[model samples]
Target: MNRKTFLKTSALASAGILSRPFITYANASKYRVALIGCGWWGTNILREAVASGVVEVVALCDVHEAQIDTCAKELNTWCTDKPKKFKDFRDCIKNAKPDLVINATPDHWHALIAIHALNNGCHVFLEKPIAHTLKEGTAIQKAARANNRICIVDFHRRYSPHNVSGMEFLKSGKVGRIQEVRAFVNYSGNGGKQKPSEPKPADMDWDMYCGPAKLIDYHSGIHPRAWRRQREFANGTLGDWAPHWFDQILWWTEEKAPKKIFSTSTKKIHDNIQTVPENQLVTYEFEDFICFWEHSINNTRPVQQGENVGAYFHGTEGTFHMGWHGGWTFYPHGKNATTIHEDPQLDLPDGQNIKLVWADFLNSIKTGELPHADIEHGRQATNMSLLGMLSNDLGRSIIWDHEKDMVTGDAEANKLLTRDYRGEWVYPS
Candidate 1:
């Protein structure tokens, strides 16, 4: 859709008192928060949000009531107040009227729920990858801007202590100027093969779960975890894991969109897999530096830091290695590498990094400052993944015009930037 059409559609959709009157904190210390998607990761985020004592999780929404009930039971132990539950996000938004909405839904549902929350005068804390496609990410950003709501894309790594320290160290001129960046995500499985389709469970609203994506028969592989393999539902490893490292890279380099990107991928390991790449390599060119990303489902080679997944930034004076699990090392140009700050050495335990991110989101709302992973930053990271996938599909480098938000002179590549929403869901345009 054109810019004019997009603005018109979104403006019309956001009509109502909910869109007109933004939520005002009004000097209150506690804000009402609603948690959406009671999945494995969502529950973790919810726990952190509640534990922080920053907000009360007043409402819960999930397509699976069983999951919501189980999570609500868990929440009661930590929070004295019982949270209202709903199977439908619309009902939760309409009735609860929360001040904040924490969205941990799958990639396809992100744009819809976030846009709805923004229109309903709620700040949003959306999980990473931002959206299933670039256009959807843009729309969510647009809604947040239009409604004057805070929408934080939780690319939690930006809040990592090691990364924060690394940024400070780099800015202190210890690493000189970074010229090249390399990121990796190598694992053992062949992405995950499709399982036999089966009937939906009685307690699960399968259609609601499949919102904004083509409805498919319930399958063992598609639920609980394996949805990353579906092209329609996800962007595979690129969308699942790339956002974290890519966002970190952008943060470290102080860069936005790449000037050009090229990628190649293969499903050589598992032909039976429906979608996603078994192995892929992508290269991104910027004005001053270049970045490389690689992912392999079959390869188990250890990275420089003796890990399978992480990122490395090569600079003129020294090289910095950042492990996804949280740690950083400095390899001087002519000397051996030294572990600058080990994550375990910090003694903060496993889950505190995520909590820090949650704290930052609440703090942002209070201070009126942008969170580290604000919507535009999230959009940039997500767009990098989307553009790389488009390059892989096109088998050529696609020049980008960030100012125009398009693939320069490549109509075919540009066409893949946005996707058609499924069912009753319509693109803002």
Candidate 2:
């Protein structure tokens, strides 16, 4: 459907309070967007948003000077006014007055940065693994609801046209009822190189990067780039990639959160759960089927996941492997399969989601229309990812009560839901 059609449909689907004529008139052009936490992914988001030509860069903020300067250089390359930059995000939003904030901060800082942005009236685009803790996720959700803002979590896979196609295939009922779901995220490490013992660069603000996470000395193994391996600052292997799967599976399976979870995991011998997991497996149970997923920090190979990481929906009718970005095929029961075509027709129009996602938020600011990955969506995915982490820590199965948002009969595991925030941090009511 075209933009007008979509807006009409969305408006029609929206509720009475949100359907005010003024709300429809609120989505004027010239949107002001800001980027928070200028890192690899954050930079990518900035580049995509800039490439859109629809949004203007009003402000930018990052704790690290190196990142700040690098982004400023790129921003100046195109934007004449040169965006306002700051080390502290609070001051940046307060002063620059952006209408939207793209949060590419570390996972640990996601909830804090996103909540603050929404509370300040800036819509948010938070990168995945929505929060380091369940309470943080819940708090962010509440903040969005209370603040009446739009929040989209940065889940790359879910934005792709292939994801939409994948969901279409599964829900078409051609596959029948899904039976079991299994996924593998193996990146061989040779063991991945150990962190280097390099001196910290003068421009890097290590403390701000480690916000909310326990402070530790700057080490090569767990600094700047390799932080994904660490437990506190980052969500381990499961949280790292599970969002890709959760974003796909839940939408494909037409489900929300899993009913129960159990996992067996530990750091690869020399690695720290604080650093890396040698091998970890998390099994999630839904009402009808179970999802068994594996994480390997040591192996790297192409497309075992198919099309830059994909999934297979096992249905009673047959097995369908969908590589939405690359290709897709179905294996029939008791019949020979044709030589699989590596290149499927994936030549799609330039992905509009980067803009549509932004447009949705801009519209939401005026209209209160939640973007695709709103706070509730973020909370659900965050809860699922954190659940996998707890299953790893508990090393066994735990029942999850969606209503209570807790693990029943497992008090130890339940404690993982919330953590102490910084003394100055104030949560939403």
Candidate 3:
């Protein structure tokens, strides 16, 4: 089905009836699964997969042996069987031959790993901000379509109970026409000054970890969780956090992409150590409305007080704010209007709500239906953020021809749609 039809079906599914037949296999064997990346968030996804009790993890792959060992140890606590370990994802996919692959790798590695798994006939559970570049995201989406595989991006908020209710409320027209939206992530801490280059850890295959991205000198800060702040490896707070909120906007509005994007950023907080900006603001112009994305590492508090990382929708009647952790609140236009608030239901650990996503993934695999958080949606959300970054990098506003998937009137910006791959790693065509 096309996106519009699928969305309508999803809306009906949300209301009480499912448009498509949902198949369930009784007494069926568990699915064989393999996990790639094995980092902190990756391990969290793996934990959710194991918690479902319907999948057996057959293999684990990570460039860092220490990470693989750590994840394996944690898995031992949850499951009886110890999974085979591999330093290379190709080996894991070839040898273990899992029915499903959980690709929780870094932003840069997302496309290659997910496309490889999809081509190998394995359904994929991909982590969000789908890929490092726009072209790579498109390639992964194409691979999923070509392979006819179930590819679900880990946009867990789609499964959040309160978020679902919030969308229902928004659809009720209580908020009126939402003309402008503000998506932001403000935190008190800054990216610390870069540490001196260090020798590569013995357990890490640093070259492989860098993968398609340029391989720079090893530093402790660049490994584990710090890669998010590095430009070569990830897209800072905008790439890390904006996709979730941008995705919410896309889902609520049913908009494919923005018409134009402009961004400006500052790196004054850090000693020019990090390539990504410490404070940034991006503006995206859609046909009907506009969105502003901002991130400031030096902020003492959030713009909406309690909502440090969330989006605010401004409508004709009132405004609604969706907090990342706290529940949503709605405020009327009048001064005397009473505000409405809802407490979040924290049923799952860390408010992840990923188990619900995993259930959808498994169901999609069984029924051959597209998942709610499909790879195409993931690509759109990721592209929104990537365009913002591209605008900032080019230091100018970019007019985007969404149909053409290219920046209009700027050759330099258009060229940045895909980055040059390092070494023998070919860019996905």
Error of 2 at 244 (Å): 1.6
Q: Estimate each model's TM-score.
A: 0.88, 0.85, 0.92
Ranked by TM-score, the better of candidates 1 and 2 is: 1
Candidate 2 per-residue lDDT, tens place, 215-253, comes to 667775665576777776877677787776776777676
Q: How would you order the candidates by TM-score, starting with the best?
A: 3, 1, 2
For residues 1-429, write the lDDT of model 3, one tens digit per residue. 444544454443344311212223212438989999898888888876776657778899999999999998888776665689999999999999999999998899999999999999999999989999989998999999999999999998876767777877887899999989999888866556656788998989999999889988887777887888888989988999999999989989977999999999974656635678888999999999999999988874634556788889999999998876788889889989999888775434466767667777887887788988999889999999999999999898999998888888888998999999999899997
- Please identify which of the two predictions, 2 or 3, would achieve the higher lDDT against the true structure: 3
Residue 76 displacement (Å), model 2 = 2.4
Better structure of 1 and 3 per TM-score: 3
lDDT by residue (tens digit), candidate 1, 139-223 = 8989999998889887766655566666667667888888899988888775455456777779999988888788777876777
Q: How accurate locally, in lDDT, is each candidate?
A: 0.78, 0.68, 0.85
Candidate with the greatest lDDT versus the true structure: 3
* Index of the highest-TM-score prediction: 3
Which residue runs of candidate 3 sit more than 4 Å off their true CA positions?
A: 1-29
* Number of backbone-clashing residue pairs for each candidate, in the order shown: 0, 12, 0
Residue 141, model 1: Cα distance from true site in angstroms: 1.3
Instruction: Name every residue pair that clashes in candidate 3.
Output: none
